[model samples]
Target: MLKKRMINLLATGFYTGLSPIAPGTVGTIAALIFALVWIQKYTISFAFILIFVCGGTLISQWAEELYGVKDASQIVIDEWAGFFIAVFGLGVDKFLLAFILFRIFDIFKPPPIRNLQKFHGGIGIMLDDILAGLMANILLRVALNFF
Candidate 1:
């Protein structure tokens, strides 16, 4: 009942995005969950891109209709996918840093990320997060070096 409605409203990832809490914040936390569970199993690189490609394509389409907007904030499958990218290759365990760095990069949307969003459909929906994830991973690596 309620769960289904929330699913419909969120288009899954979108609902996660629309959280009264910062959408990026929730998305990054979700990412940490994924990282903790998944990194133990497969190569984070493969998993990150795979999740990005699959989740972004399906949910972005759902969100387009659900929000009546091309890329609504509520549609955060993008975030989930993107977060995977951020922490993908690093193999770091500092959950808080991963979350913060990922959120910052996602929010800042620097350069290529901001430009990438101009695309429509899956690519536009998904690319920004991939870039954000990469940026976050780099930051994570740098931070790890210091700490």
Candidate 2:
């Protein structure tokens, strides 16, 4: 069906998230590669970036239905969007640090990140990762001040 195809294309990170182990990590890695190749190289406007971030919510929610499970591991677009949030305007130099921080927050789900999961559907799925990215970005920004 078209929905299955759509989920396969978008939610799976073009099937990159379909990696047998650590799919979320794979998705994040895909996002990191994208940031280094395209996002960091080109200076897109905040408005355009915001469009992707906001659009993720819709696609993620739609994809959730096809998976039949809340925040399924197969749905890694959230990871992609979160990594985008983590790096946003940061340089490639900060990639490692930002990635570690984002991964920690995403994996551990401290505070509001865990709380966010309570919401229904895609809002629930994407919001926590978005928050994790924000948290990681904040930490990266702080570290940038010192280093």
TM-score per candidate, chains pooled: 0.75, 0.91
lDDT of 2 at 118: 83
- The RMSD of every model to the true structure, in order and in angstroms, is 3.6, 1.6
Candidate 1: where are CA atoms >4 Å away? 1-11, 39-48, 142-147
lDDT of candidate 2 at residue 8, scale 0 to 100: 71
Per-residue CA lDDT of model 2 for 1-147, tens digit only, reads 887797678888888878999999988998888777785457535775677777777887888887787887888888988887887778778888888999999999999799897898878878898899999999889877997
* TM-score leader: 2
Whole-model lDDT values for every prediction: 0.70, 0.83
The per-residue C-alpha lDDT of model 2 at residue 130 equals 86
Q: Candidate 1: TM-score?
A: 0.75
Question: Could you say which candidate leads in lDDT?
Answer: 2
Candidate 1 weakest ten by summed lDDT: 6-15
